[model samples]
Target: MASMLISLSHFCDKHGPRILLVTQAAINGSTGDELLVPTYPTDSYCESCLLHFPKSSINDIRSLKSNIGSQCFVSTQYSSIRYQLLTLIIRRSFSEETMIYDGMPLVFYDDIRGLNLVMGFKLNDENARGNERRYCIIFTIDSTDHTSSMQLLSENWNFITGGFDRMVKYICNSHKQELERQNNVNDEKSNFNLLGKTYLRGNKVKVPRNLAELTHDELLFVRLHKWNSFLLNSCMRSSSE
Candidate 1:
């Protein structure tokens, strides 16, 4: 039994790369909810991928729960025909234990027909802190036949889910580290001190060398002093004249 197991392992190692490994997830898992296709615009094909039948084909694009449309241009007739651009999310998966990473696998129906799919991910960091940041991944699959494309996507469902999950974990950790660095910068800025003091009527105000150190009231005080000095100089010049 041991010898048979060893032989099988060696055989798989030698030939696994040549065979398409299909997992249960790819067979059973659903990519995502199907989006509603608008009928007004006659152009059902995406200008970028040139794939047709938006409602029937593309899977799990954007967050339907949040009212976000699929990343593909075929969301609607107005959207599909007007934009005429293709966007895809390139997703990657990282293994924490192995410290190894793998990118998303491509599903091909016909190599002779040319490229059919493109995917990419985007990070929305504005107004978000660390893990709260939004990461959006888009997959645009294009094919001449809707049935073939859908079947290809279904067969590769496991890869899609695994890639999405791993990428999320990686991004969250990186984002947390970035936030820590930014906080350190703020802490350093807070420790900054002014170089000199401003004296007014025997009272002293510390004049910050860095503009970032200035408060609203301190800024007003500086402006007031400048205006007063300008007025005094003007009066002196008038007297000389």
Candidate 2:
């Protein structure tokens, strides 16, 4: 997978194009190997393409297996139209239609700093017996959403499942960091005893009785309740191990 991702990154660098790729592999089959085969153009442009690729080009790729062997099964799949559609849906749903400027598919949501919601598709292979040519839609909720976006994607199983688990793990780590910062602030507040002290050396100060501090475990609990158990467990495992 790392090599494949690296190859994809290289491909992007050389082509100067950004695309998302999805692959379907047979049980115990190599995802990389299946993607190298030359198959029919299953590239789609929209949700309509996603529904159509299976019926159209998927079979042609599968047929190539006989002549070229499994090497012919390796193919990349991508779709700009589907990405545009999904991006538009997400942007509009999030009430960020204005973010779509200059016909760019990406839109930055100010509420989440460093977060740009992007939608794109890439080339991939469907590992079928004969000619299995298909492309999968790649929907990515990047690390910029301050963790919550990843959580939402993980909980919503309807979204494409690839890479989502890792994304959620990253979000959980970010959440932990934020929680630790808050906890540190609470600790500092609690350390200072300003109760019943109206004036101190010609300076007036006010303070609360106790500051609320949340432990990492407590934050994880909150995340578990709000997100999915599977994601929480994965996060915990990642953090601990």
Candidate 3:
């Protein structure tokens, strides 16, 4: 038996380095006719050996029920479902580890064979204050693919996909909240600019204008200029009198 670990980062830059380890059992001393093992490795592909035999000489490997552990592996019949699950798992794992301080985004995609998972997390200028988080997406064939008994496994895989989708949504919402907070801060700074600087009763700085008047950048700038002139003229008049 042999395993192969393939890194997705080599193929795609958007998806950071993702590892998929494939372990297969060699059949009848032939390398090409190897049976794909059900275990998910941190690598993408792990082959038993490089020795290739004639296709006619190789025999098909029997399938078996999958007994994957509770780790972050995903089981799916549909390639799309598998791709989505793997992407979500990687994103969830990354989010758990790092604090998201910026609005940089992460992207994920499965390889053309649908056997490899790719994940990329990049920090934009907006998120430069945060840590550079890396993401890994992984994919493996459903264990049932090798066996005759696939009905139960297929159903279970579907259920898992549903649960995974819900989790992904939650993560997305968290990112959204971060963006909303950033926007709120920007709005506050903008409002400060629009309200001709005024002093509150407590000596705290205040904006003379309301949010409605300062809602748009264009309107805010115009209002700011008008308010500035008004304040200057009033001060001058009081001093002269």
Candidate 4:
């Protein structure tokens, strides 16, 4: 089981899914709805794997085998209307929309790739709007050893899906925390007073009572200069000692 899992991980590193995003865009002076776009693989290993399959887009690579091929130029637009429609059909057939809404991922046999598997699912984000709101993952598996690979994947389905769920939660929580931090910073900026006691980068600084009044920028410069001088003096004393 462990060896199978490791091989499966390595397989995924090569053929993992690239996100098929849908976002609003302006086209010919009109607003377009759910404009589909492809993204680079989120994993560094998967990105490195791209160096192997140069003629193939993430979607088109299902036609390619498990082995790495020589680098070749690719002119086909993976995000073209036809490919988009094909992906849409694949999603619908795989019940990808249902999976997104119901919070369950679907793994099914590839319609075209024979004996290979396809997994489709979405990550929910409360802050997203329209089609941009759906963080979808759809990938097809191509393995040299299909029998053992299929068995391992089928048996460990629950664990695989749970890991994906946890990953989504971690990402969402991190984003929420960052937004909260930005909000706190803005609130501090709004509440700050400029005319009262001396402040250097939001910290109070003591100045001589007899010293001339200084503008905010001038005061900041003075404080910075004082810090530099103190550091220099400390360094000099340490060197002497």
Candidate 5:
């Protein structure tokens, strides 16, 4: 997944971004047709294509996978498009009107900082025989409205906004050093706190004040209570049975 993401980013470096259209796909042959399809670049400068979607323009190199987890790439465009779980497709013009996703506009806008979102399809293969594996496109439109989402997507960008490979190398080294420092501290703590053997029963426990140094009368009272409890429990059990 990392390799693919890296490959895509590098491809962008060479060939630029590949644009696609996205929309809700029809299922079960209900519509018996595609929910959406791709639009090719035309000689006529599509005022829409000549222009970016809205966040400024299309940022097409899309989503990250769970296996690869966190990813970083140079955020070359203001916004990028990700095709997720079920609905993503290449950009194209539709004969009929399409459903408008209100929040999609923000993806093309530069309103949020450090907002590089990875969007795309996910393949799941949890079923037996493995033949049931399916591809599902995922999506999130209300991210801009979400503070935590915005902040989380904001920080931890492997995306080198400034430089390219050299910048990536520097960041990687810094992270490696920081990780090593943390590991060292953890090792020190573990070594310092080590005990070759431990006897949990050796720990002392005080007797309850109420039960301490009871008189003969009190002892008799406890015995009576114990007998009463046993009898009561027995009676209850018998009744239940």
Candidate 6:
């Protein structure tokens, strides 16, 4: 037990914030592959692997749940992503395990597909089998397809017809340690483009900083701008195809 505790302490100290484990089946084929980014490595496709996000991203994690037009007090648009982003605090470069050590929150984006068959008798339109593509967000505490710890973050009709598939990620023992490491290096240096990637300034690097460089409003604006850009870019690319 003593040795086990030491090992865990080392792991936590070495890798701040828990890791996000994604299933390889979720990333099958081309559609699933595109969801991957630089931080999300695919060395272990069949088995669960870690997902990374900068702790600074928590600035934009200010998501609120809404149930407008929801059938069961859930949600209507299916595009609401409030629940996917958590309120939990993830500190960068923590020496001890924080809230992220016990139950880490993760964010993932993907598409849930299902075949729907319409009755042959109904020929007055809406009778054909509709496309099965849907934008979805699934986050769970454990590494499994279905679990009591699982929560459906978001889902919306894929009107653009782009192929997307399963994506799972959350904070856990597996959360990326490198993100925190890089964040610290950048903070000390105050220079972007560390580790071959651009470190967003202003609100883009919204994580809690010891230096108190940026204000809350500035960070919020940066977060909103980023999300908007990402959403718009995705739609444009898919629509043009």
Candidate maximizing TM-score: 4
Tens-place lDDT digits, model 6, residues 179-212: 4554688586665456556665544221212101
lDDT per residue (tens digit) for residues 79-156 in model 5: 223333111221211111341322121122122321223222211112112211111111122234455444433332
Please report, as a residue range, the 10-residue window in candidate 3 with the lowest summed lDDT.
Answer: 1-10
For model 6, what is the alpha-carbon lDDT of residue 168? Answer: 13
Model 6 whole-model lDDT (C-alpha atoms): 0.22
TM-score of 1: 0.30
On the 0 to 100 scale, the lDDT of residue 27 in model 1 is: 10
Cand. 4 TM to true fold: 0.35
Q: Candidate 1 lDDT, tens digit per residue, 91-122?
A: 11111132222333333333222223222232
lDDT values, one for every candidate: 0.26, 0.29, 0.29, 0.31, 0.25, 0.22
TM-score, every prediction: 0.30, 0.22, 0.29, 0.35, 0.19, 0.16
**Clashes, model 2:** 28
| Model 6: number of backbone collisions | 7
Go through the candidates in order and give the clash count of each.
7, 28, 22, 0, 27, 7
Query: Sorted by TM-score, highest first, which candidate order results?
Result: 4, 1, 3, 2, 5, 6
Please tell me which predicted candidate would have the highest lDDT against the true structure.
4
**lDDT agreement of model 1 with the native:** 0.26
| lDDT of prediction 3 | 0.29
Model 2 deviation from native, Cα RMSD in Å: 21.4
**Tens digit of per-residue lDDT, candidate 2, span 1-241:** 1011100110121122232232222112343343343444544232212111123343422211111123112223332223353333333423444432222234343332323333222211121112111111223332344466545443443332333434334434554575568668856665564554433342223211100111123232223222322332333233334
Q: Cα miss at 172, model 1 (Å)?
A: 2.7
Candidate 2 error regions (>4 Å): 1-87, 92-162, 193-241
Q: What lDDT does model 4 reach?
A: 0.31
How much lDDT does candidate 5 score?
0.25
Q: List CA RMSD, all candidates.
A: 27.5, 21.4, 27.4, 22.8, 30.3, 21.8
TM-score winner, 1 or 4: 4
